[model samples]
Target: MGNRVFVVGVGMTKFEKPGAREWDYPDMAREAGTKALEDAGIDYRQVEQAYVGYVYGESTSGQRAVYELGLTGIPIVNVNNNCSTGSTALYLATQAVKSGQADCTLALGFEKMQAGSLGTIYDDREQPMMRHLLALAELQEFAMPPAPYMFGAAGKEHMERYGTTEEQFAKIGVKNHKHSLNNPYAQFQDEYTLEEILASKRIYGPLTKLQCSPTSDGSGAVIVASEAFVDKHGLADQAVEIVGQAMVTDMESTFADRSAISLVGADMTRVAARKVYEQAGISATDVDVIELHDCFSTNELLTYEALGLCPEGDGGKLVDAGATTYGGQWVVNPSGGLISKGHPLGATGLAQCSELTWQLRGTADARQVSAAATTSGVALQHNIGLGGAVVVTAYRPANR
Candidate 1:
């Protein structure tokens, strides 16, 4: 790295159901971006560049959103990478600081989504997910709502191949919903029993409605700066360094293996995670907290193996052992994950960044990973989107 990159500030709005809030994207962006700037104790003019992420917005929305912050005449790039859009923006901002191209930059993500299961918005053209859809078609019949079917099939395959039980999957839903009870920013904060989760409306395969991530409206922002800038601003105490990050797209096995898990981007997550660990000079065991993509409960189980948290096919065992929750091997998704925290597409990844930063700073209040568990002082984040991309990131307190 040419220069160390630090996240000096972070902020986000409470995730809400698609139509639950009357505000528009600009309002979301302003709230989050303003908070970040205030946290950094810097003015918007200090930002040399910006990368804004969104999935369901029109072109130039990035410029429109940032206008609420300032008209600094800085370069602004709009980014769209499905569900990983938020992290993609953060990745770019990190690069800008690491490459010494900018002393300070802003990564912002926001989404104003429509309610209900996500459907193709552009029906007249070739859909972007056609290839992934074809791969899934080779394995099983298509379900009416595609997301549940896709990830649910992956869970089904894991069960058949590894003897993972449906109860194990439901347990993930229970764990995340319970975790959300402590997160004010989470969309769903109520706790549920494993039986209640299993008995909820079945969407596809082994998945229940409670196990799925709801469409959400929210925004998150991070201010990234070079180490020199952090020192100059006297923000070392609050800064979190971006130690390692990698983004991977679908590999050949995603299509050729005819495995639903691979088709759902497990390999991508594994590859990206491996690269991140190498860059950070640490193993999975070194991570104190995690906020992985749990867009579906099944994906969380699948990701445990992909992230090297456990051996392949042992994800169910890890879950049963309670290895991923508080007082376990690691505290994963203390932010309630997507299943409970809400998945606002573009905002999801940056929201993960915000949570992890708070975690490293020991400012997460009720949901903070315990001091005993956080001795390592490292946090990991995973965010993915089908059609498909995955971004894995590692963070630690800058003062460390």
Candidate 2:
């Protein structure tokens, strides 16, 4: 791999249906890819590799969108890692540029599930081995199936194991929504409170509907360049470098073996972040803004400890102290996260990259920070795949 890879540009559409009608994959891909190209001040001709992530775009996936940029047979690749699809593409793009395989690469992720159904979730009997295991568990535990709501059970287990409360989970909601209020592209731009969150209808145990990320369909893209390429193109003067990256996969069958809330591959998040920080010679306290994978409100809490932002069981403390807020010492999820910003499956990771790119570039408009801006300020993103596959990354300004 090359010495370094940098994010030259990033783009994302509003985290909602584009018009009166809902959204479709092709349109969103075009919207996001064009925006990224514009932001990078470069033409699609510069992109040598394209990695498009989509969950259910059906026929003609990544290639169709890159074709929007005047197809030049740019070795396009498609990736689908459940919810972590976008991040997977991003990881690959970075590797491509780092390995000298491509000087410039594009990673785009988009989806269109707002129209109605969830598009297409393979329910075939001839699925992976993990499918059979989960099915048997569901048959045994009839009432409480281990689906996306496992996060809720994890929340309950957190409280049971560490005396955390529903109100504390609500605290994370209040903080993130407040941060979202400043993000123009965020879906829900308002401040919520613990009381209000508790008052809302419950989805699973203590998890209210508002606390859960809705099934949002959206699109986002990120452009990466090699350090040599950036220097040649004068892009290093304005780019976000990748300081760290790490991906870990755990046992997919999360039935009786693992604890629901005991931190799934959490050690991986820390290890990855630490590696980047050590390589870049920076610490967690050095980061001024962040985009976290908050598919469930409970996740935000766990990430704090996992990322070493705060001590274990101190997630509530970090949020309550106003540390994760904009004016606070360090900001987390200024983009509203999957909770308020909308989780467009494959697009989530790219969205995080877009947000951090804007932030480090000091182009965040209303949400910009005035901190001791590391010309290469850090932007961390975490994305988890089916059950437990996760990939976390940290980005810095390309120039730096």
Per-residue CA lDDT of candidate 1, range 1-400, in tens? 5799999999999999988988999999999999999999999999999999999999999999999999989999999999999999999999988998999999999999989988887899999988888878878888878889899999999999999999999999999999999999999999999999999999999999999999999999999999899989999989998899999998899898889999999999999999999999999999889999999999999999999999999999999999999889888899899999999999999999999898888889999896522435999999998988999999988877
lDDT of each: 0.93, 0.76
Provide the lowest-lDDT 10-residue window in model 2: 139-148
Model 2 residue pairs with clashes: 2-98, 236-399, 239-397, 239-398, 240-396, 240-398, 241-396, 241-397
TM-score of each: 0.98, 0.90
Error of 2 at 225 (Å): 0.4
Model 1: weakest 10-residue lDDT segment is: 368-377
Using TM-score as the measure, the top candidate is 1
RMSD of each: 1.1, 3.0
Clashing pairs in 1: none
340-384 per-residue lDDT for model 2 (tens digits): 888888899999888888888888877776552566467777787
- The superposed Cα distance between candidate 2 and the true structure at residue 300, in angstroms, equals 0.9
TM-score for candidate 2: 0.90
